[model samples]
Target chain A: GESVGLHLPTLSVQEGDNSIINCAYSNSASDYFIWYKQESGKGPQFIIDIRSNMDKRQGQRVTVLLNKTVKHLSLQIAATQPGDSAVYFCAERIDTGFQKLVFGTGTRLLVSP
Target chain B: NAGVTQTPKFRILKIGQSMTLQCTQDMNHNYMYWYRQDPGMGLKLIYYSVGAGITDKGEVPNGYNVSRSTTEDFPLRLELAAPSQTSVYFCASSPRGRFQPQHFGDGTRLSIL
Candidate 1:
């Protein structure tokens, strides 16, 4: 069955260190990808997004790299902070549904101080 | 703006009970979605609406129903709630398709015992 998944279910990193989270998507037709962070007791928050036209996109302290050839996506967080502890998710737009978004299994990032 | 807002931040339902999850967006976005997050799993699309009076099934539509009466409101209905239905529910909205980012509300934690 077609699905999107994360390479790691959980990741632990020390504060001030950089963290890298990986994701794999199944649908090749998916052209748009996004990264989201979900804190405990809250909903997923938008982090960064990369369109197929670009292989990489950078944000404040985060970066999203897209490898369409392998259907792989990655999110890199720099200078990780204790506040960054949360489950991170990657999503794709399967098709145009007026900005509809599809999600992947999440990876919990534990920023240990 | 309030962005997206979900009602009943937390709810405990007995088996066979039913309830409605309310979602509203003040962004005037035309696209709204309902998603559920399970333990160790990613957010699964329960339903989505393209606009007022238009709704469609998503990746996981079983045991759930949704209706979009206006651009700002999209509600999800759970009938005969089961243990399997226990999860965190989220509501999100985007301006429209075309690679726009999404804004999410604080999720609703639902547990069926």
Candidate 2:
């Protein structure tokens, strides 16, 4: 079955430093991708998204880079902060006559102050 | 605005018990979805509804059922609860477009013993 996965289960970074999270997807038919941030005891919050036609998209201090040829996606956060410590997930939108998102296992981002 | 609201922030159920997780969105989105997340893992789609009176099964919908009687509400029902059903459930809603970002609720924590 086609699925999405993360390269690292955890990522550690110091405050004010840059952090990057990587994700790999197996479905070539997916056209849209999204990044979500989940804090403790809360739901996943939408961060940034990019479409297949566009290779990159930026919002606030976050940027999402999509590589269709490699089936890879990456999220880069600038000036990491303590509040950024949480789990990050990447999801791919599969259009099966309807919209469906397939999520990755998630990468835990730990920012040290 | 209360983007999305989920009832009973936490719940406990015994084996064979049944319960419904309620979800409602005030944003008037046309797409609603239910997903379950286990510890250290990503969310798995349980079910989704595109509009009123329209529903479809997702990746992990075996023990779950859903209905969308109105555009603002989509509830998920679990029958014959088992230990495997213990997880964090989140409800999300998006606009009519396939590229729209989803707004999520806080989520409900369920423990089945």
Candidate 3:
């Protein structure tokens, strides 16, 4: 079965510190991957995305690393802020006839001031 | 323009009731998707459409139905709602391409009694 999974259920870090969230996928055929952030009472927001062709992609304050050899993915947050606290999810797009996304059980990031 | 809009931000339904969760996007995206998020879990894809008049079932499509009659709208139908269906439903859209990030609407919180 194809599945995406996270290594941590919860992560706590001090403000201004760096945070790393890890994810793993079982489907090697997946070509695209994405990370999303969901706050309380809101929908998941797109954070960043990386295609299979790239090993690392950087955003404003976030970075996504894809390791196809181990079938693992990771999100790195630089200078974590209190407002950065939210649940992060990793999703893999499986292309069949149509594109479908498979999400992982999320990792909750808590930034403390 | 509203990136993605979902109506009925919250709803309570009795078992066996039927309702439609309306979703509309103004981004002119050709791909639309419906997902359900359970507590402490990831978003599960229910259905997706590539373009107008083309729809396909996703990983978890048993209790839900969807139609894409237009490029801007994809509605999800829940027939005979069950208690297990209590979750947050989200609508998202993306341009037709590999690694195109999805834009999501604020989810609808549905409770089944």
* TM-score of every candidate relative to the true structure: 0.91, 0.95, 0.93
lDDT of 3 at B43: 80
Residues B1-113, candidate 3: write the lDDT tens digits: 88999988999999999999999999999999999887766788889899999998887899898989999989999999999999999999999987788899999999999
- Compared with the true structure, the alpha-carbon lDDT of candidate 1 equals 0.87
lDDT of each: 0.87, 0.91, 0.90
Q: Pick the candidate with the highest TM-score.
A: 2
Name model 2 segments beyond 4 Å from true.
A1-8
Return the lDDT, model 1, position A93: 79
Docking quality class, candidate 3: medium
Please report the candidate that would top lDDT against the real structure: 2
Better candidate number, 2 or 3, judged by lDDT:
2
Per-candidate chain B TM = 0.97, 0.98, 0.98
Over A24-86, each residue of candidate 2 has an lDDT whose tens digit, in order, gives: 986999988989999999888999999999998999999999888999999999999999999
Q: Who wins the DockQ comparison?
A: 1
TM-score winner, 1 or 3 = 3
What ranking of all candidate models by TM-score puts the best one first? 2, 3, 1
Return the TM-scores of chain A for each candidate in numbered order.
0.89, 0.92, 0.92
TM-score of 1: 0.91
Candidate 1 docking class? medium
